[model samples]
Target: MQAMQQQRQSAAPGALAAFARFVLCGGGVGVASSFAVAGLSSWMPWALANALITVVSTLLATELHARFTFGAGGRATWRQHGQSAGSAAAAYGVTCVAMFALQRFVEAPGAVVEQVVYLSASALAGVARFAVLRLVVFARNRSEGAATARPVCVPEGHVLTPAGAAGFCRAA
Candidate 1:
């Protein structure tokens, strides 16, 4: 094992497990938001009701993802929170697009059917969210006493100096 070779966590959970946990957390949030929207719609403006629900769900989802999905706790920075919030907004946009397509192109028979379609769309968004969270927002060395991922120099054109190493790794 050369110093330039990267060392990654051998015990890190597989992608499937992380995705499963993500789905579990997202499903709970989605179910609660759906009910909240329905309950609020009777008294509030439809747009406002939906918006509030989205905001609350996004907040809850971010914490849930940080703790359960990526296993990072007590170290979330403002930048990380911002990215998580942005990912939530992006996922909501995906759901909205799916809903629009369903309503405009396909004739759904009833509200229940529409809800099912929406849930399916949310699942796709969940997958996207999991990938983004794993790759960007909550990515860190959370493994207790385990090896964490490190940067490695590429095989060819490997440089020894710090300045040259940075350039070489990026260029490779």
Candidate 2:
């Protein structure tokens, strides 16, 4: 019983770290998508540009989230990707419609109204995506323990082990 508690305590830090990494990766993708849509809006309709950017950016973000955040890699078959993509598409469509409606109803300056609507809708959409990803897309399997025990390299050669490198692996 004590060992289980200790294990859970130790796992808390790793879970928090993973969540931070996921947020950073997702934020990068969001920023890129926003910029892409904003820039392309000059030539195309904002909705169309936003949809294009969301599809491309979400695909990239999903790979990062699956491998780093969830510690699940071999699970990302084509079918899984398709399912995730469909989920994201549905979320994006709803977000777009909500933002559009807000823009139309909120009688404020154009820029202010646009920003407010997009920010609120994006936040809601992000939470929805996270819930779906956790519950459905990257749902943990029985092999999760084995997978989480291994080390993962973030960038370059900087590696992070499940229980800190020194605890999990040591020089012999």
lDDT of 1 by residue, 1-172 (tens): 3434422322335678878888788888988787787688689964577678888898788777766666664445667778877877887777677767877887754667657766787778877877888888766534442444456666665547856565555522
Stretches off by above 4 angstroms in model 2 are 1-15, 140-172
| Ten-residue stretch with the least lDDT total in model 2 | 6-15
As a TM-score, model 1 comes out at 0.67
In angstroms, the error of model 1 at 74 is 3.2
What's the TM-score of each model vs. the native? 0.67, 0.66
The global Cα lDDT (0 to 1) of model 2 is 0.68
Query: Which whole-number lDDT from 0 to 100 does residue 142 have in model 1?
Result: 44
* Candidate 1 weakest ten by summed lDDT: 3-12
- How much is the lDDT of residue 11 in candidate 2? 39
The clash tally of candidate 1 reads 0
* lDDT (10s digit) by residue, model 2, range 34-138: 667778989998888888888888778888777666656433556557767877787688768976787677765465556656666766777777767766777
